[model samples]
Target: MAKAKVTDEQIIQVGSELQKADKNVTGHALCKVLGGRPDRLIEVWEKHLLESNSDENSLQYIQLSAGLEELFQSMSNDILKSIKSVLATCEQNILTQADKHVENEKVACAERVSALREQLNDANDIINQNQDQIDSLLKENQIINNKYQKTIELEKSVVELSTKLEGYTTAIKDKERIITEQAARIESINAA
Candidate 1:
């Protein structure tokens, strides 16, 4: 086909104005305004219009089915991986915190045991001190008992000595009386 003498810019411009006015760019109508062969101009313009509309539609409604599906799948995988990583980190933190808590509890138990041991030792010391006091009191009691025994023995000796002195005094008085009687008898015989 011979290249149409009519410019594409003119055809598109008039066509846009006609479309805006809600008029059809028919062969007779465009031919009357642009002074071209109606059939040739309309045919060429229609072909160009069809090709441009095709390109415009391609731009307006892009063919993204395959690319978008791939992108969505990749994003889903990335999100899943991120979530798994976050959950793993949280689990690790929880375990570490639990271990720390267990260690703290063990330390607390150790401290309590140490304190209890100290208390036990103190109690034992107090008991030992009381036992020592009891031993000292017993020794003092034994000493007092020994002193009382000696006192009792001394009293018995004093009573025995007093009894012996009384016996000796009575015998001496009896001897003196016997000597007086014998002397009186001798004097009576001399008188006779």
Candidate 2:
């Protein structure tokens, strides 16, 4: 005997009604409900199962996407915090180094100023000593000049005394000549 042909719509409707009734919609159950070949019902039931599972998979994909988005936001926040911490630490380090550099410069400047003052004091002392030596030399030079002037005056006196002695010698010679002539005349008279 030839089997009755069930329509595709009728099979699909029966499968849906069985599912709504909370009954197993297997090929054997459809065959009993619709009096059709199990093979035909099995094909339609598998198609419906594939469609339902596809819808569930799409919902799960949406949920998974939302979860991934939340995770991405959390990670970004963590990265930003870490960057801020690093920047703050770098800023603090730069400030500390700058302070140290300023302190070092101040110390160096102070030392240089102190050294310059010491050099200035030494120069002043040297200048004072040179001035003292110049003063002593000037006094010695004045004494030598005074002694030279005294010697020149004494030489002038000696020259004047020698000229007076020469004049006296000439007068003495003239007196002796006159006395010799007088003594000669006296002897001649006595003889006569």
- Which candidate tops lDDT? 2
Query: Which residues of candidate 1, in runs, are more than 4 Å off?
Result: 1-76, 172-192
Q: How far off is residue 181 in model 1, in Å? A: 5.8
Residue 185 miss distance in model 2 (angstroms): 5.5
Q: Candidate 2: RMSD over Cα atoms?
A: 26.0
Lowest summed-lDDT stretch of 10 residues in model 2?
A: 59-68
Q: Rate the local accuracy (lDDT) of all candidates.
A: 0.87, 0.89
TM-score per candidate? 0.48, 0.54
| Candidate 1 structure quality by residue, lDDT tens digits, 57-134 | 888666569989799779999999999999999999999999999999999999999999999999999999999999
lDDT tens readout by residue for model 2, 64-95: 46778899789989999999999999999999
* Range of the 10 consecutive residues with the lowest summed lDDT in candidate 1: 60-69
Score candidate 2 by lDDT.
0.89
Model 2 residue runs over 4 Å out of place are 1-67, 176-192
